[model samples]
Target: MSILASSFHEGPLLDKYNNLLISHERYRAMFDNIPLAYMSMNENAAIIDFNNAFSELTGYSCEEVYMKPFSFFLYDKKDIEYHVNVTFPRFKRNGFARNQPWKLKHKSGREIYVIVHGNVRYDTDGRFIQTHCLIVDVTEQRLAREECQRAESKAQLILDVISERVTFHDREHHVLWANKNARSNAAPEC
Candidate 1:
């Protein structure tokens, strides 16, 4: 009877241990399999750990980036300054920063635009431990936005050079935009 009771107690403990191990594995798999680039850095901003997505985005292997400062990957000095002076302070104070624009230097020597989200972690004693980051590549999106803006500016210039008055109105009949000639040729109100 005593032996049977001891075995039953051990079974539940073993099952609980196995469940803990499975949970850890699941967490690690999810971290690695996430589509966006993910990285963890030490308090000094040195690269400590990174997921496969980060390796793919930067075209850099873990060996190449291990223990390197985050600024080592930056494409511009101004960006480094911004990170140090603005982003870092805000992140430290608030424990998080969202959608911060960054330009990183790729292994192929090209600049890649990214929006970074970062969260700081603290130890049980409330001491800063590390920062975890998620990075979304925005190079294509930024380029598309710039192209659209340039096209709009060029169309506006064409309208300004024309002799005819051109006015753009919204559905509410409010003037959105008017060419220079249209603005100048407007009649005085009755």
Candidate 2:
């Protein structure tokens, strides 16, 4: 028998209930499928739930991490210090945090750099309940940026050693950068 036919008779109430069920199902599907990592932690910072992406990122299954102190994942001393001294205090006061960078220890014992966006939840009685976090892995981006800076520094070193004066300019001929040699060898103003 069709679900509509089987479930307590068809009526406006049934239709409304069906629509709400469908909407909830759709929301669950999207939450599970989205690439971004999402997690919720209870007031004490214990893990409540996390999406698939978060599980993959942390290398910890929901079953393994559920109700565990989320702070246990933070292994780096610098990251821990910053989180405790700066991030947590700020978040507590503001009830939200954004673009907060921290490192988490993966299940494989490697550090994973992440940026977190979070919101705190409170009960009507002014009690803390849970906080939601949207985390993004930025390890690759940080490495690429460091690599780029190194390459630029190496190029600059080479440019500085050369005999020719090298000055970078904008389209309007405004000077943006000058190599060390360029600066030293620049002609004095008339």
The 10-residue segment of model 2 with minimum total lDDT is 4-13
Evaluated with TM-score, which candidate comes out highest?
A: 1
lDDT tens digits, residue span 67-133, model 1: 8888888999998888777877778778998988889999999989999999999889888898989
Candidate 2, residues 55-99: lDDT per residue as tens digits?
A: 898898778878877677897877667776777767766889889
Clashing pairs in 2: none
Cα displacement (Å) at residue 67, model 2: 2.3
Give lDDT: candidate 2, residue 105: 91
Give model 2's TM-score versus the native structure.
0.79
Residue ranges of candidate 1 with Cα displaced over 4 Å: 1-22, 188-190
lDDT of 2 at 81: 71
Q: Each candidate's lDDT (Cα)? A: 0.89, 0.85
Query: All predictions: root-mean-square deviation over Cα?
Result: 4.4, 4.7
